[model samples]
Target chain A: MAASTLRYGRLRVVSAVAVIGFLLTSCGGSSDASDEVRVSAASSLSLAFAALGSAFEALNPGVDVVLNIGGSSLLREQILEGAPVDVYASASTDTMAPIVDGGLSDGNATVFVRGFLAIAVPAGNPAHVTGLDDFGNEELLIGLCDVVVPCGAYARQVMSRAGVEPAVDTNEPNVRSLLTKIEAGELDAGIVYMTDVRSASGGVEGIEIPDAVNVAADYPIAVIVEGPNTVGGRAFVDFVMSGVGQEILAGFGFVTP
Target chain B: MSRAQSSHGPSRPPIAFVVLAAIAVVFFLLPLIGLLARTPWSDLVSLLASEVVADALVLSAIASFAAVTISTVVGVPLAWVLARVDFRGRALVRGLVLLPLVLPPVVGGAALLFALGRRGVVGEPLYEATGLVLPFSIWGVVIAVTFVSMPFLVLTVEGALRNVDVRFEGAAASLGAGGWTVFRRVTLPMIGPSLAAGMVLTWARAIGEFGATVTFAGNLAGETQTLPLAVFVALETNRDTATALSLLMVAISLTVLVLLRDRWLRPQ
Candidate 1:
């Protein structure tokens, strides 16, 4: 019985893998050269960049668009470690500095859009959180992104500006994970990107940051100098900097840089 | 008999076999060598002195010790039950105890979160009544380590219990020794080496545990962030701290294994 149960478990995992592979294969072209563009962007750009990717794909039918979105620091490290990426879009100039300093980027990077931090709480605001000051309340459970990530860096700056040393319950690796906890109501509040609030739909509600205490995040985009598909990389970067891309980003609550 | 043949003398192996074995050793040693080679020896003292490294090392020791202690207290009785008691659903209970051995630590952590997090099934009511939360706290780290490492001790002691001659336990019983007395005297002495071995195994696993601890406890400095979590977060922004923590972990774990190997691992 145990052996048969183990076999059944293995069979389920195998079938799950097959289904995932089939879905991925159906997503886009399996061709080479300018046929595909692999863009690695920060998590904040997920919705905005994905929109641009679809629009760019619509414009250029033969070329496929693949995006790898994650924390800026992690994405930058992947690039440094020679990940197969064509375009590099980061949440901060500091994060992009490594690529440019290493001569791995093609010339100067273009500032695309800016992001700002906001306190996100679960819908209905059960915690009755007001602002940054409320974050310091001992009774509330709060989350902040780890300092290494861009969102966390901005949140730290904001906290210092506000002169509030709030006790944190969890230091999530990235904004997405913290956002997940907040939306699930596990945390009373979390500091995340304004775009994250917009993308959360009704699951989470965003509490605006006062302009005086808020920090503006600088986002930079560059084409990889050592890329296998330089032309595709430049085109993707161009598309992201284009008017349509800016509009799409604005629709996602990103400020025009 | 086959093992006795190998222990007879230091015999020469085939050239191909020697070459392959050398390559395997080098393959494993290469990464450790690289870590050592990149050590900023000049700043080692200052790097270790930093609050991040200091707090992480202290927390790792405390959490792992707590995990080992708790696992011994709870797991010894469990091993005895699984080994000696022939009860209904015994196999199922045994399987559940050993499940963590095969399950991924991260998945184990996720299950822990669902069962013990503030909004968790049992956790929700517990917190409502008592105002206790587990995740993102020091106790959470201990719980995570214990959850993943308890199996090491349980399995080791269970194996030892099953191998012991039942006549010894029966002899103690016939001599008017109570159940608890027999367990503390005859049964325990019969498995002395196994108990020591189990404790060491639990300590080793508990100290090295990372995935479940991070996932369940959530990394927060001076709270839930143990050495592994500290090394991980440090790796992103501070290479020096990461290397220092890594070197410390390797040195400490190696010392433990070396110190324990002869004491408890030797065969009778």
Candidate 2:
């Protein structure tokens, strides 16, 4: 009985394999140029860097910019795994420190832009949260970045400086998540980069944090020592530091470091 | 003369079987061995003592268990329907039920956001009606895990139900048993093993569900973070804790598999 029952199920295994094979074949074939700068960056830079990628392509027609945006910690792990990457622009120096320490770079690390952390609330601010002090209220659902990421570390720094123990309802892995929470009103407020507030386009509103309680976030860019496109990586780094790069970064609300 | 004949009749190839098994064992065990060999055992106790690991493990267990329970409650009946009832669009429903399995977990998380996020189509009214939010909460982790892992239980139970003979119910009914009593007395006991196996698979899937959990629930240490989330966070700063967490996950999964094999799959 068992043997007969199993025989009737054999078609399922075959069909599953066929479906997987079809998907693999469809996904495996792709056509793109080889000279593209495979730049892996932090997720927070998605909106700004997407615009920058197109602008860079226009500036250098022969080169394509392949952007892999993710959490800085995750990006660093992939780089450590020896992924085919050229330039790595992280949201914080802490994430870049280990790679640079391991001699994974050609010593081209530089801070290109600075960002200030601020409290972002929904457009209408229904919670009536007046300032940073309101974050201490247990009733207010406040989201924050996890301490593993740069944004979260900065938020921690800001909170510690104010001597305020903010009641964090959740610690998101990235700023975008925190932004989503505030915009969706799942959270009354979240601490994110000024640029994030700009990119949110007023679905959320920003409350400028007092300088005494704000932490500065810096972007560190470097060329991988084992990068296939070392020349292009260095060139891209220089391009981002030049006047045009500053303009682009500034357009995203990044203050010149 | 009969004992002598029985001894040689068995003729088991012990040497070849053991050698082949040894090679397979090493192939599978080497990576785990390497992780253990590299673990910083000196600081292992303190590392585990860290509040973050504790929080993450507790959260993960709660969410994963909740997910498995929810999946079993909802999925088992659906499996019975699929296996026993001939209905219109049944095949399409089966395919649609497995959609979460085929779609990448990240995509599942994105879909969850569209459905349950504060600004979501359904979530908006829910929030406005009761000031309740689903995303970024402990409940969100359960929802994400259940969405991705329920299909495993459904498929398993459906397969088992299909194999269960309807004659047992018929026999019970002919003996003057009512339908509900017949089903309870006849059908349920036969497929108990498969149901247990399905529960184990569902639990394992829920425990390992990372992409959807992180994307939808976000990684809040005591609130939304589970073991996989803990492993991820530990990977960020401490390599030793990451390995420990991973080994713990592997150990739990292996233990569950062994228990299922012993308790559910052994021939009666």
Give the best candidate by TM-score: 2
Clashing pairs in 2: none
Candidate 1 runs further than 4 Å off: A1-39, A46-69, A227-232, A242-251, B1-24, B86-95, B98-107, B160-178, B186-195
lDDT of 1 by residue, A113-195 (tens): 99888999989998899999987888898999898988888898999999999788888777877876777667899899999
TM-score of each: 0.82, 0.86
Q: Per-residue CA lDDT of candidate 2, range B1-268, in tens? A: 1233444244675898879989978977998888889788787777677787788778878887898899888988898899989999999999988788788887788788778877788988898899887876888988999998888788877887787778777889999999778767876677666667677777888999887888777777778888998898788777788987887788888887887777665433
- Each candidate's clash count: 0, 0
Query: Would you list the clashing residue pairs of candidate 1?
Result: none
Model 1 residue A8 lDDT score:
38
Q: For residue B239, what is the lDDT in candidate 2?
A: 77
Off by over 4 Å in 2: A2-33, B1-34, B113-137
User: If chain B of candidate 1 is superposed on the true chain B, what is its TM-score?
Assistant: 0.89
Maximum-DockQ candidate: 2
Q: In candidate 1, what are the lDDT values of residues B16-98, reduced to their tens digit?
A: 99899899789769989989987888998998897777788899999999988999999999989998999999999878986
